[model samples]
Target chain A: MMRSDDLVMLYSGPDQVDYAYLSPETAGVYQNKHGSFQHRSLVGKAFGTRIRASNSDGWVDALAPTPELWASAVRHRTQIVHQLDAAVVCFELGVRRSSVCAEAGTGSGAMTGALSRSCGSVHTYEFNEARATAAQGEFERNGLTNVTVRHCDVCEEGFRDLDVDSVDAVFLDLPEPWRALPHALRVAKPGARIATYSPCVEQVHRTRDALSTCLDLRTLEVRQRDFVVKDVLLETGLAPPAKRRKDYQNEDDAPRRYANCAFLAWF
Target chain B: MVDAGDEVVLWTSQGTYLFAEAKVGSTFRWTKRERVRVDALIGAPFGATFEIRGGALVRAAPRGAATTVEDDGERRDNRWLADDNRAQRLDADDLKRMRRDGASGEAIIDALVAGSDTFAHKTQFAQQKWLRRKQNKYLPWVRVLEPRAATIAAAYFSRGNLLPHRVVLRPDTVAQLVARANARDGAKIITVDHSGGVALAAILERIEPSGKALVPHRGPFEALRRCNLTDLDRRVVCFSLDETPPPQGDSLVLVAKTDPIANLDALLPLLCPSAPIVVYSDTVEPLAAAYAHLQASGLATAILLSETWLRDFQVLPNRTHPTMSMSATGGYLLSATKIVVADAA
Candidate 1:
């Protein structure tokens, strides 16, 4: 059951996601492009209820909050890790519920939320004081008690400043991750894994050079392409497709475009 | 650590693997000449490599710590090397004699290198490639991998869906599906696993500590036999698809091998309001139909029908490029949030 002050994700429609903190004290309405519903109206309702707007026909689904949806709907303070990279990184790190993991430069605490959700404890550090404070506050408000956020330059001070002595895995999303390798190694247990995310090849080269002494280092990248599922209806004068006309067809527009095919749904 | 009767994954490479029982008095043969007894691996820790010697398993370096594919030096190229009979001086009788003399695989490789006329002329990468091929042949070694959900999924995935009974999910798809479901922590999950048990095991692996999973046992409950489950893991409640109502759950996951359009009808009623719902399928058309069905029926919101495409890269010094081999489909996932507009929804 969802308690008061719980963070709820409001799904209004396609690509329409909003957040509603069911704060009992704050008597207000959550207004979005899809609709506006009174916070009082949603206070005690079950999470999956579809509530209609008081003044209009607009309605939204009040769904339970999860890290995956939060990442998609979070207001970006910085470029966060998407599901594609996050999935691969977590799998490569072999993260588990018993694993104690740490992360550096917790930008927006997006990946930090995921780590805390997946593992036992998360010691997330950020060099920037503002981001760290905001992340800590967010974690607290979200009831993520298993996470401890710290504001320190991990490259210089290291993770030992916190209570964490050994970790199962550590992820670095810093600009110069090479500078933080020694600190990462200090807290890593035997057979621990480390992951560094770099968009460019030069940073990867520098990081590899710094990590040359480590055993079993692998350099890899993963990509995910989403295909829109739809129905294609021929332009023939027969009865139109049963589904909505807005559903576009999945077309391969590489070589040549077909004229008679009416693509409908873009899922 | 593995115990007797545990099913362990013997991994040599992505392309070479074998699933074997850890019970003693059994033997696995990798090649015509390479075979090892299972007794030595019964109590060994996962991720440790053991070599086959004299038809018995012996401890080798830990898995990946002694990888031979890593080579940086490229001072010499194959420009001066000729693909002729003169490159290797070792004949068939010489190899047989070396084997008869009880030379280890590494020693034989070293002697072969000493006798080769062009071993020094090959590039570092070429030498590493030659060494890997020869080492795997003469001195077979395999890492004893724990049969975790992710590990099992990877093993089956690299095998390219050879078994019809196993789930055809790629590791990427499995990870993403688990992420989308948000089944971590102590959330109650309603899972329908058709990929034997790998799908259910993956979810149960995440909802740790006090988490509970209610699996609809359509047929055989293979998870009990296939996975290394503790007492807590067996807490996964089972119900028939027809007998008991789909247990009310905070999360719902269906890795269906069949069309999901009808299964959704039976499973959607008991899902807790406002929970995440994830449906995975290997093919796209069925999932597309399911997406439309969910949309038309208004049983779901915030639905996104998407698939994951993976491309592997071969990273080596002066040999960095995308791998030549890749699977066309990593698997597809339809992610959405379930909603209720009525009582007990």
Candidate 2:
């Protein structure tokens, strides 16, 4: 059962997600396109729990918050990392429950949300103070105690200020990750897995040049699966239109700032 | 350090992998001349390399395993080469005799190259390609990797005769499927795996120390043992679908080698409203039926059916291109969010 202060991901559609913080004191109607429901009514309901909207006549399911959902629903303080890139990065980095990870230039705290859930603990460094403070507050609100948001330029000084010298994995979402490779390698454990997300191909070449000794480097561009399966029925209310798969991407059409491509290298 | 009887994937330097147990008295045969006893690797750490020295397995020195030696040999170009089936001078019996005498993989490769009528005359690019293809077969050195889900799935994929529908449930695709399921901590994930246990292992790796997964498979789930997962009793419960009903879950996954229509009918009821559902199949016929059923029934919305094929690029200084061989298919996946519809009754 869900308790007050537990982070809840309320869903009205597959892609439509909204955050709801439950408290008995702030008893009011929670509103979204799905419907409106009383905040107090959700206090004792089970998770993956459904309740009818008192006003919109539609319904929403109360589900547990995951990194994928958070990536979709979190307020876009900056263009967040796409879930596809995040998934590939998480896997290629080999992060697990026992790993310690570090990130640079925490843009919008989006990728950090993924890294936090994937590994044991994350020490995220952001160059911007405002973004750093904002992400810290957001993590606290979501009750994520395993993340630490610090205001530091990792490219400038390295991951030394946080007092952690070595980590199991490292991720760089900065514009110029070549400068931080030496610093990242310094703190990364021997045989640590490292991945970088850059928007351009030239950055991949420059990043590859920084580690000339590494062998058998692989570069992958994981496109979102868009070729719609043929011959599936589509009623008017169920699906938007049967025209094209690009139509589904209209919701996320806003220009994204970080994570255009991924460069993964094993050391 | 791995102990005795631990399962490990013996990874070849040339990119072939197989699952083997570090048993006390068993022998792992990579090739005729590379049957090394497994007892020496009993306590060696994972990622350690083992070589066959006098029929005994022993830790071998790292073979530079570094950068691919880029040698653009300019001796001869292959413009005049013709494929009339007489390109190799070594006949079948000669090759058989060389193998019977226990020639090393490298020695065999050298003999083959020397005996070839057109090998030295081929272009640098063609020569490299030929070397790479031969290396996959003749390389004898092995690296011991932990037999995790990814490794096991890769090893199974390398050893073929697989159902096309099951290929998408391989390593990279499994990661994407888990994301599509919206798997999280403490959430119940119901899986119907027909691809051995790739889907289950992918989810378990990410949501460890938290969630519970119930797998309804038909057999003994013998493949799950290959993953060598610890704490399996608490995290997963296995049963035959004919025996009992599974608890309702937040998400559903169906990767069926047979038709997925039957599995979806049985598992869809356990998913709550707004739960994400992912169905994988190599053919669109079965998934089309399953997709239409969910759509016409008003049981799911925001439904998207799609498939993806990944191409890997080799990044080298002067010669970068897609690898010579690429997998043509990753299969189809039908995904949707289950929603509640008011009953007309």
Candidate 3:
């Protein structure tokens, strides 16, 4: 494991200037990754040409994706998971700050960031070399010494390196969560919570079917739900709306301010 | 005070102050002889009116004197009219005062209207002002607000699941609900949270249909936010509790888990024992659902939706047409223990 002080070298600071390297050729593959990874931010100017100091204030991630694991995923530019899902997983999945967790398909390292925040350590797997390198750099940048981002793909590589039957939680946000289900079932402690973030219904259905063979899969879908908090006028005749409309147009037209629903499923 | 042919301020139960011109006539006629009735009036200029009743000073009007009325049928017709006049006078005074105080007329109007005592008045004034401002500030002398269906829909969808959180009603809808609640003679108005309770207070501000004002019961909104609230989940927990909690009678509950004004909910519950309610909070997971959910849990119920649901949620173009989402709204008439999902949509 890299030292915590070594992780601070990714930022552009006085000491880590030599290590603050940006390879454009490496950035080629990740140019188009979209799940909230390509948005422009006003806070990106701090990413200078050197390793800078690291701080973990809530505001660090307020504007930009400051969660080190998420940033590692972003650095690789793979299809990263969203923050909401990560927060839900960390807070609701009963994953404590001391638990050991395993995450498959470290595509963008989002789950890795989330797992690192709660558990004592996280063993995450990713296949792409360039993505792994970027993620490693991000991990070092954010001073995350707990997460071990492996270069091998979980399907073929498996969890041979880690202890058997040890992890507390398994979070799968991959394309084929079922492919990793056997690996998860084999290693996931009994009654351990497994959360998967799949967009399409087919993915959810397939994952559920696979998990049911051994696990008491409780299928749950989480959508981004918004609460409209407007001032209630008593004297004037304003109360709850006469109806509750459940459907929404698309995210682009509305821009997610008025309402947001995150369709999610848990196993 | 009962002198015949006296010029007096005939302060009625309503908050209207009519400059009654006095004459030797019947009660109705003589009541108009410069006779000021402090009934049905929204804002009367301080010491503005002098009344003549039966040729004597029957009653006197004081400056900045606030009065209450019994909201009976006699002074009803003039309520709206008197309110309008009072508003107009306020408007006129506001305009002059602004000029005297070296402020812009528009600024004065904005301040006064913004400070309006009621949401209805504020909305009405703002709608006009905003429209005029848009016309003046923008080009083409025209501003067309596209039907914000997409935005409303997005907002609705953003709430993830509506199972356990509190929904804020626009002011007008609350008023209408309060009026309906007032009309209910023996029943209590149940709400989801302290905000709703405040809404109830606003509703019962004038004409509490019930003999006294409708007290509010408070609940939690924090639960709504933190907990993944679902309809089935709400039913499972609230009904399964061994202790049959006290029934909420005719009260409003404004549900906010982290509201600084939790005391508001506390005050209302103490004032009206039966009016306790639950608010769906993002932080506090109150053990109640929307009013409809409560009704389904087998408690006799009346569910009030905020009127602005249409505009705020983008269900209808305006507050006129029936659009989507009303299935959970309107007061529900149901037996306690029988949960029925009414067609609010």
Candidate 4:
């Protein structure tokens, strides 16, 4: 197990965008759109094998891998996890360093990057033989001995491990996570945390229903909105209040005001 | 910062004077010729007059470069301050000269900030830093004003039309380029690309794939095109701004400028009072300022500036204008029966 300073997972838009803030000095992990992480830096930064989440979409892009472990793992393809979702999951779940985790439907090794960075070990499952093979290579390249990819459908081949009730976290990004809820319940400890990502509401409902028996799911959804801000002059003498009031009350609650709403959000 | 609807005159060292409403809560700079633009004849301790017009500025006939010609008589250097005249008395001639001297509205703001500083040294340093930074950041934007204006005009004229002449992008963005595009008849949809030109090309490809994606390469001929785009069964014509003058036939519609402030300024002369000028923006400040200016200037009887533009200041709106519509939140249309007739004709 690799022990490092505060493990950071920063969310960037996608790909190793050249103009991003991740250039060296700033070391952590960058997630691609396909949910894969890659270790990147300005030539003078980083040590050991570069670990990145692998995906079918060429989501992982690492410059030069110095470590033998990273070179080997570079060939794998798995569904990598996005930095945003990963950070949210890690924080909300209160994951501890060196904790054992379970992940299902490893598309490209994105979530694996997160688990590998924060936990002691991860047992990831992938049904696709080709994907599993790719993931295996990535594990070797990153020199990650802790994360082991098993080539079996988590739903069918029940988890067989040294300990059943000691897993720290469980994450599912499959098409239908509800199907894996039963399997998740069987393997999870009493209060182990679980997280899932689904685009559609129908799937959210199904997963919520399926996990209801085993997990006491408190939080439901995460929504993000990006907006543009405009400054409006507050008519006349209200300048003092407008300038002093840092936190604005909703216009419905105010008499004199200036306002505009411009933003788009995604769930 | 000056509020919207506040009438102010700007002077410059250029021949033409400018009389423009503040479009944003911007500050002025202490660069060369800025004094003529903002402070007017105020700091000319030697006493001087100035004029303003069309946002440009110039100094009026000068009495003398030196007031009290005592070489060592401790004459207060007027060059370090504004002349005695206030912002209200600035006229068109001063604005014209200021424009000729390349003065900007931003200069007026820098002057105000400089004037507020308690320490003279600190004020000079701050103004200098601001001018340097602003020059570096806004040069690219100022250079493309012409083309940007044309693109906005085209989009504005195409409002309520189909997806061919008009296209929606970033349905998720506050500007709602897609929402407005979808709502308009004949509106076409396009995805956002990292490069602005690439995004425009993607739209053109969907409308006409005949190697016309090289429209920019088509030179002056780019504006004149045999358009065959249709949406919701309405006929549409697609052309680039550099190539096409405003559609000069009867019943034709024209888009003005992508820059919201300039766009409104152009529309003020063309639009009729009581006509709805729907405005939208990814941020509300520029649009609000424009709306307030239009209303206060007696240009429009009623103006509707949407509350949508105040989204995020970071994501600069594409400044796309929809035709035949006051911008819907600054991206909507500025409508008037006579204006439409005039533009179409």
Candidate 5:
């Protein structure tokens, strides 16, 4: 049975999936393309079971939330890091189980969730108060106890709350990552890995310059290309004339492909 | 050469000396006419110019050139060399005597310039080119480099034959693969390496001794053996392909060599949900097939990537571009996270 306050993915179809935190007290109705449902009634139901909406003939499945699901369903209060880039960042930072990691500008808590899942503890700082509070709420609702969200500007004040040279890895996803590099160096232990993500080359250059003295730096841009599968009818020479014509006309159609580029620096 | 016992390439006017040792007091029979002593190079930094016994001077050639000239935003004018027609006045015997007299490379170059009848009429670009050509030939130098994976790969690739045993994995690509695999301390990793253990070396470097690496091989790993990783050997266990132990859950698996798809399938049941699996191949076709298979299985989120590294020579402050020659392709990497999908409704 699904528990109260659990984040669930309400799946109607590929195009109309919704994520909602189950609540027992609030008499709220959640509506989607399928139908409307009382949020209170979703509790105590088994996940992956279809439930009929009270107002319409449509039905929806309440699915459990995975990291990938949460990534796609999370609220985009800020520009969220793509899942591919997040995975690469987590890997480059060497975020392992029981490892201590620090992150700056926890926008949308996208990568924060990944870090919390992979590491022992994550110290994430967000400059905006509202985003930090919202991320904190999300973390609590998702039962992510290993993460600590702080509403402080890490660049101006540095990571003073944490002990010096204590973290195992540091990840920066800020506008001015170069400005926060000194603090990252201060918090990270000797031989600890640091990774920074920026959208432009100029930012990477600045960040690289800032870290050149203390760390062995390597910069790369990771690109992810996704391919989808689709069935194509073979046009055999012995095929029927009409079927052969149809197959020839459909040759131009292909599945959609997605590619995204992310610039990264690690040491 | 800067370090003792390091392998270096000593370039001279006749030809290049391959695999020369950088030992103090060692004498190199540079050419039939010249003999060079290593004592003059022991303490000198790589790329430093020194005068030898002969009138010829040699500069230590670093693996890569250092930035010295600043870009003054001047464009090359090809038409400026149209009217330049001059002949050289300095003979070979004079240069050889000058080298035997222990004249500096700069002094020899100055003499060569003084002897060139057309040196005054040549354009600045042509003059610089001529000076550089002379410096490369007459100013003999040795570039000393530490033997890492990159240098080893480069040496093998430049042999004019692409052998499968020689892993052409670049240093950057190795770093990317390790990172993509999420290798870490205490993690159990399974690898199938045939590129003389280059991949294994990289994995061992990242995971250290805390993690255990299982390499399935029919024979000894020559590349890894050359690395002298005796202390870390305890962490690496070798097994036959058909009789390897089953992997525990939540372990990283890296497949670099033959039959990646088969290896991945055999290891699939052992991986925990969301465990990262990285497969590398020299070509994309195999990885593309692997990607399709993984996608069809409905248990993976596979992403395909190909990394091409471009090194740039920052010649001048304002004139920076990619080096003239570069490796066209390093390799293709396919990274996927294993997932347990619920039964379809």
Candidate 6:
């Protein structure tokens, strides 16, 4: 049974999947299209089980929270790394169970959560104290004990809190990854992989140059293209034989395009 | 493995090539004028360069590294040049012989510049373009890459072969789909992969051992076979499209190149409420219909998003702009969280 402070994905309707923290002490009722249900009612229930409201016909499914769900449901104070870039960074870094990883400039802790899920431990450094504290609380609330959120500027001080040459991988999401290269190198074990994410080529070039001496550098950008699938209905028109009715003639169903650009440098 | 008969990619300055290694004495012709012994590359490291018969050297290009183009600080205003002034001092035969004699790409480019009577008079941009053109022609470097999903997908997409299969999923798209689905350790995921199992392989890579995948397909699992994922096969339960999946709670449902509505309808009941259902298609009509169906039925909620991908290249210092050419359509994604509706009072 789920207990107090357990993070759950509360599903009330097709459009309302909320990431909620279960608290027995405070009276927090989750209201949705169906009805309202108190957090207290959800505490003793098993995950994925439906809970009903006392006053009305409202019900919500308290589902277990996964990293992806948390990422989508979490509050975003900064531009967060979406799943695509995070996965690539993890893969490029060769993050595995038992691998100790390091991250700098933890923007929203989205990647921090992802790393925490995959690796043995993550030492994430965020320059902004407030964000770091907030992330630390979020991690704790989510029961992510594997992650340690530090309110420190890694660019100036480096990952000095960790042992030198102890880290197995490093992920840099900083504006100036080149600045942290020395510290990353110091913390990284021999042949340990490193990955840096940047949107601009100038930053990539700088990072590439900085890593050239010590690491075998390779750079790439991950681009995902999404297509909408529809069944076309052909129809005939009265005007001309050539203008016969076309199948699936929804004018608004035209294919649309969206692109996310994140430059990844791995060595 | 860098075996004698394996197909490898040779990334040169101009473009990438798929080279099949033959016996030791066999010569691999790079071009009509350029050829190298297969033995030269048989045992070499993937990204290392080797000298050929002549002075020409070819390096196996590193994976994901863009072709290097250094911008020299040479300033010139845009000006139209007369065709008559574009005279070359070195003839075609001499240039070909220089390449045959083992001159490097840079050396050949320098010779071309020195041989051009009007080279100095051209604008910096024009000079750079000229150098690029020459370098592409003379550079013999080729980086061999292992045939992973990303490299193979890129090569196939570049060759326009990804269309017939209706699997235009890029590396980024695969990564996004896997992550968004939250396919991790012990997570149960249902995948309908049409991209030659590349998507499935990516999912398996993320969620292994403890995680289970229900893959329903119509034909032989050639894609999965090619990925060398036999080790993870035990964790995967394969079935035909007509077969019913065993009753189990799946945390994620990933649909590609299939009917999203029908698949979701069949699979939604087996998913844990609040499970994410990610649908990918080349077009949007079906997904839009599925979104409407989900909303109308109150089966899912949160943001029902349809995102299209656009990639732009930042060329750095001076030439910072979007690339002139890119794939117009990467694809579209429809992501939503599933919800279970209880009977009203």
Each prediction's interface RMSD?
3.1, 3.7, 28.3, 28.2, 7.7, 5.3
Candidate 3, residue B192: Cα displacement in angstroms equals 20
TM-score of chain A of each: 0.84, 0.83, 0.61, 0.57, 0.84, 0.83
What is residue B119's positional error in candidate 5, in angstroms?
Answer: 10
Query: Candidate 3 lDDT, tens digit per residue, B1-345?
Result: 113322223322222222222334433332333322223221222122333323333323321121122232331222343354344334657556665677643465556546554424334334443434422321111111111111122222333245334354333233233333321223344443433233333322222123233223223323222122124222212211122454434434333334413423343323232132323332322222343345343322222222111211111112322224432331211111111221111
TM-score of 1: 0.86
Q: What's the lDDT for all of these models?
A: 0.74, 0.72, 0.39, 0.38, 0.64, 0.68
Candidate 6 per-residue lDDT, tens place, B1-345, comes to 456765555445555545444356666666676566666666665445443435234334332333454456666553655577447878879977985687766787888888887778776656666766665566544555544445554554554463585576755566567666777777778777767666766666667657777776543444455444445557677755454555454555554666888888877777766667787777777777877787687666553445535454544346556667766666667787666544443
Best by DockQ: 1
How much is the lDDT of residue A226 in candidate 4?
25
Ranking by lDDT: 1, 2, 6, 5, 3, 4
Tens-place lDDT per residue, model 3, A73-126, is 344366566543454455435454446888877776766766675567888877
Question: Which model is ahead, 4 or 6, in terms of TM-score?
Answer: 6
Checking candidate 2 for backbone clashes, the offending pairs are none
lDDT digits (tens) for residues B4-25 of candidate 5: 6544444333223233456765
Q: A1-267, model 5: which lDDT tens digit per residue?
A: 567777777755434557887776876677986688777666766554456787887776666554555776787888777665675566556555658999998889988977776677899999999999999998998888999999989999887589998998899999999999999999888657788888877777688678755432555555443333334565558756563244233322333333445567776
Candidate 3's displacement at residue A103, Å, is 0.6
Angstrom error at residue A262, model 5: 4.4
CAPRI verdict (incorrect, acceptable, medium, high) for model 1: acceptable
Of candidate 2 chain A, the 10-residue stretch with the lowest lDDT total is A252-261
TM-score of chain B of each: 0.83, 0.81, 0.25, 0.23, 0.68, 0.74
RMSD of 3: 29.8
lDDT of 5 at B142: 49
Ten contiguous residues minimizing lDDT sum, candidate 3 chain A: A29-38
In candidate 1, stretches whose alpha carbon ends up further than 4 angstroms from where it belongs are A1-4, A162-165, A213-216, A236-267, B1-7, B13-15, B20-26, B32-34, B38-45, B62-97, B114-120, B218-226, B242-246, B342-345
State candidate 6's DockQ: 0.25
Per-residue lDDT of A112-184 in model 1, one digit per residue for the tens?
8888888888889888898889989989998888898988999889885644348988989888888998888
Q: Cα deviation of B97 in candidate 4 (Å)?
A: 86
State the lDDT of candidate 4 residue by residue for B1-345, as single tens digits: 223432232322221222323234332332454422333322222113333433323345531111111133333323555544542333557556655687765674454444443223233334344454433332211100111112322322333243333323221121222111111112232121222231332233222222122111222222122111224122223433354343221111112224556655543333221122333343445655665565456433213332222111111122212222223333333221111111110
Error of 1 at A75 (Å): 2.3
Q: Give lDDT for model 5.
A: 0.64
lDDT of each residue in A1-267, candidate 6, tens digit only: 678877788765433568777766988777776787788887766665667787786666777787766666678888888766776777556565658999998889988989887788899999998999999988887788899888888889989689888998899999999999989999998657798888878898788778865424556666544344454555568655665555445533444343456888777
